[model samples]
Target chain A: MPSLKTLIPAIAASVLLAGTATAGDLVSYKVVDYGIPSSLTGKAGDAAAGEKTFVNRKLGNCLACHQVTKLSAHPFHGEIGPSLDGVAERYEEPQLRLQVVNAKEINPDTIMPAFYRTEGLHRVLKNFKGKPVLTAEQVEDVVAYLKTLK
Target chain B: MKTNWNRITLIAAACAVCVGVFATSANATDWGPYQVDDRRSGYTYMTDESRAMQVDSFQNPGMIWVEQGADLWNETNGKAGKSCASCHGDATESMKGVAARYPVYDEKAKKLQNVETRINTCLEKNMQAEPYKWESKEMLSMTTFINNQSLGMPVDVKIDGAAAEWYEKGKAFYYERRGQLDMACKHCHEDNAGGIIRANTLSQGQANGFPTYRLKWQKVGSLHRRFRGCNKQVRSAPFGNGSDEYLALELYVKWRGRGLPVETPAVRN
Candidate 1:
């Protein structure tokens, strides 16, 4: 498996090849460089509460394909995805927020569903029309918990 | 000598009884959940009345696309000024049993072709019109309209000959790991089937009743889209729409649900 460091150059090359107009692109690299407010800055959140949110189906549901320790009661924890052992050390809080909110923004071809950007992306359930799967507050909480991984 | 003969006869009778018991247990085991018994027919939750209701409610946003397909069938396009109806006639009659045999090996192309690809080919070659983009609303509608005509037929994706290669490719892809997260399809669908993934019970991830009306989606969608969704959930970089990997996986899924009746628009949670 290629490390994220190795994959970044290839991803950058592909982005260049796709001819994306960075000026209008929200959360684009240009915007990141231009010092737009990153999605990560917020009040500190409880990791214990966030841990509950991670395993809760109504919330994060992170254990579906990921194996996370300290949450063993949740059945059907999948091993298809990697174990989240040292994720905080790999990515900063803002990058983590971007990934959780919408991974495709970073990689246009990502399979990871946009937890925050529900509009125009998700096939809306009739009852939950216009509602995101995760709210901004919940994302912040999860991000807070993730930052403590190290 | 007579006592010895009597004892041998008793032992033979006991052996026969044991064989009968074993056969009965085996038959019972075959009917249990997760056993893909050839003798038993596939089961579904939708009833005849419910299915009729769903069909009648074609006014739904999802079915609106199908209605567009109904119009497209008769409308003329391309320089030839010929409509799809010109050759296929009434789709209800012409397209019956067509969906069941799809994703078949195309001898000319020397590859597997699904219903959508074949339809595009017909549009380009026969009608002389531009082909619809794969996974476009127009294409989905057209394909759904055609597939709806073949409801109740058994799925018959051929797995022999050159088509076998595609099936194997699909199987390998399903088991292979990828993405930053590094997971495979079987880790959930097979290994943890019926187990709880948070609140929802993990289905075997069968694709027999596709273009299903999912509670989460609140609309009917194709199996390919579902495959894409699963990959996304696992944090893998997704294959592009209509990519060969997705197509191969679709073929494998269809084969997995072989012998199950085509549920063109099933409701699922």
Candidate 2:
């Protein structure tokens, strides 16, 4: 087994990120800039929880458009974006977080919705007007889960 | 020797065809890019269980709504003391092919009108009757009955002339990504038709079998109801029935499914 030194930080980070965005976390409404490194302040992320959010239809909804081999057990992985089978082999954690934050920044015409940023959208549904798809810590959780593919 | 060579070539060709079929089935929606829009009906993607339900009028629950619609057709209730039959005579004659040509331009209103709205138009203008609410059982029954009059007739809505602009708008809407999930109708219906989405096989989103009896809903539903459900799934606010945006969309979608045989009271999962 790997030393607790490495596993402890990741474990503690996941715990911290587990409750990062409680219902009271209204700071998600603030102006969030894309392409920022670790824009989520000091929150930690849980890969297991991130995996749940990644597959949840109401949360990330990422499976609706992207195919991920890690999630093959879950049917209907979409075909819109590149396969996320070996995503960690392609990009670093920070880069993955940036993509999750705002993929349109990399390619303006990309159909992937920004999971963290809040502004510049069209006709946001009334119930979800001010909410982002994934909270900041949730984005980190997804990034952590993705990083494990390698 | 020549005959043997010919047989070898024939076998190679058969193998190629088999491979092509396998690719489509195995990959489902994994095609490289969206180049053309496929307009096939959702019926092609249905499960055998649902198909059995759709084909049997005895098993199809939509027939219940169709029966209710027939009853409403002859009943006179408006202040004008006129039923639908009174104004139009036999539906098989007056309403024949009428449903096929709808979502047409209304020059007086300068808007696209659908079957439900057209019913409302006559109710308020000719009969002075109260209009049915969107997705109400009464409207579903009436729309299904009128659509059944066009059953087996090919869908043939106009996408040109005054409707041309709305058609373009709807085309844009189909291709344009919207909602928090940022999905376009074409992403699933056009580009990924025949692919499985969770438990449901994705169809081309054709309107041919609409006012369809959805086994999921356990009730008959209008095309707009299906549209609204899709919008909500993508985390978008659904447009109200007969609204301008949706009416234009209906025109575009109907045109997409042009020539598809009508399957009103059709069943789907």
DockQ of each: 0.06, 0.32
lDDT at residue B19 of model 2 (Cα atoms): 99
Write down the worst ten-residue block by lDDT for model 2 chain B: B30-39
Report how far off residue B60 is in candidate 2 (Å): 1.6
Q: Candidate 1 — which residues are off by over 4 angstroms?
A: A1-150, B1-65
Model 2 quality (TM-score)? 0.79
Interface RMSD in Å per candidate, to 1 decimal?
A: 9.4, 2.6
How good is the docking of model 1, by CAPRI class?
Answer: incorrect
- Lowest summed lDDT across 10 adjacent residues in model 1 chain B is found at B38-47
| Residues B28-82 of candidate 2: C-alpha lDDT, one tens digit per residue | 7532211123545676677768777877889888988888988888989689988
Scanning candidate 2 chain A in windows of ten residues, the lowest lDDT window is A22-31
lDDT for each residue of candidate 1 in B1-269, tens digit (9 for 90 to 100): 35798889999999999999998886764433223543222222334454454546463334665677788889898877898899889998998888887888889877778877788888898889999986677777787788777777877888889888999999998887553333468766666665555455566677655566665776667777888788776555577666778778888877776766665655556
Q: Tell me model 2's lDDT, rounded to 2 decimals.
A: 0.78
